[model samples]
Target: MSDEHPEPDGRTRHYGDFYGLSEPAGEGDVTLVIGNCQAESLRIFLDGGGLRTVRTPPIHELVEADLPHLQRWLARTRLLVAQPIRDGYHGMPLGTAELAAVLPGGGRLVRVPVIRFAGLYPAHVIVRPPSDPSLVPPLVEYHDIRTIAEAAGQPLAEDALTPDLVRRVAELSLSELRRREVANDTVVASDLFAAPSFDQMRTLNHPGNPVFAALAARVRERAGVPAFTVDPGRPVLVSVHAPRERAVLDAWSLDGEPTDHWVVGGAPIDSEEVRRAHLAWYAAHPDAVAAALARHADTLRLWRAITG
Candidate 1:
């Protein structure tokens, strides 16, 4: 690893310098593997090296044209090093699919894939040339310490903690929290859709009614959630849960006036009265309130779900 280049935003850029080395004795048999989704750039280097480049068919390309060379090198070469393109790092671990193409004829690919940061695009190197494949090092897999502690039926408090265990527990806790957030989002979305306004809009508007357009606009502004309006107007003003201001406005008519009114055309209601009215409205419309709560909860949940 080397110092990363700085981007305009003071964040480190992905591009960086990388180097590889071949064993002095096995230099003649060595073949450096390189690949890229944009294959033209790699072709220039391959031509420069005077090494023959073989492009596998589009459907067959994964490790690029380096599979055959990799197989040959693994058989004879003592050291294998690669500097893969930056964007492809996530898929570095070699899977069975890639191994099926790269391993020598009749070679039994390992079930557990090896993890290496040696810059191999889409597939990591597995070194087992001189040594028997069975003698090769065990594949590395990361696990949080909390899992181990829970499995051992041991307490995770400081009184009996190890550094590894502490770190692992922290990792596991974060992962669990992320999972919970995802579940929360699903529950919220379901609740929002259950709102009376949503149902009213669906039944009245022939699919695209804009009667509750004001509520929809408010939702877009304050709630930042997806919602539709209803037609065949009635006293029902169902809306997903929103901020206090938006909720009050939707529950009772703002009517383009600053005054708060509980009904369609009543005198301005005070802040305290507005609060009471909002509560009463929500109480009366339990389904609508639940939908609003779900709508808010879903935002947090959906984010966790995607990230986790």
Candidate 2:
């Protein structure tokens, strides 16, 4: 649901050099690298230097297989830039429990937290309070999964899914299912909760005779809201926030299923807000973010492998 809050004043705003490239040989210079099921690419730009392309790897090879060379390159670089694998980078926060309950029984859960970066657009940048004093000079910050994971004492697993881990995730899912049931019955149901994205609908297997039992249960727990049953005769359209609308549209254009309609939300997803909230929550409880991200990483890697 839409909640109106006073927008921050312009006077309080400060601008800084949010983007720069660093030389690979400089003492503090490190390459900012990013990769996933999509593709792997690295650029060598000296902090004062211009952009220089160094290497690019196939998306399939990078995520589905090992890239020790890439890891070594990252170890020597100054910064790492990439998206979060677990918890969403945008949209609402659907916790592990909630996601677990919603995931189709036979199908597993996949979380891909992305931070959008496209050719110097102000709106694309994420603004947040610096997590550390060292990160202060820059008004905005970009994080790499590697840096954060190391700091958290929970490094990324080469293999994300293991029997033990899967079982633990399943348990969390069950908890989410119960929680949703409670929320639906008691909490204020908002429009945001009512609108499920196309991706979400696929996860729930839209318009089916019965809604995904676990997902319905979790929705109840988190919002105490009732699940919508898609009208089988009519096409079910999925809607996404504005910021992500273009990317989502492009993706759907390439591979989206033909449906009755696909709708984009009226407002921006404002994922930066979600990230700020998550960071604050993590700051208060350090281990919590680490644990959640670890689970998220594994599932994402697995989803990539299977889908690729």
The C-alpha RMSD of each candidate to the native structure, in angstroms, is 27.3, 24.1
lDDT of 2 by residue, 26-119 (tens): 3333333333322121122112232222233422233312234444444443333332223431233223333334333332222222212111
lDDT tens digits, residue span 1-308, model 1: 33584332211121111111222221122323333222222222222122222322111243434344345444532212222223333354333244334544433221110111111000111222132222322111111122222223332332232223222332333344345435432111112212223222211111112222332333223322233333333333222111122322233332332222222123333434534444443344444333333432332233233334
TM-score of every model versus the real structure: 0.17, 0.22
User: Clash totals for all models, in order?
Assistant: 8, 23
Best by lDDT: 2
Model 2 stretches with alpha carbons more than 4 Å out: 1-248, 254-269, 300-308
lDDT of each: 0.27, 0.31
CA lDDT for candidate 2: 0.31
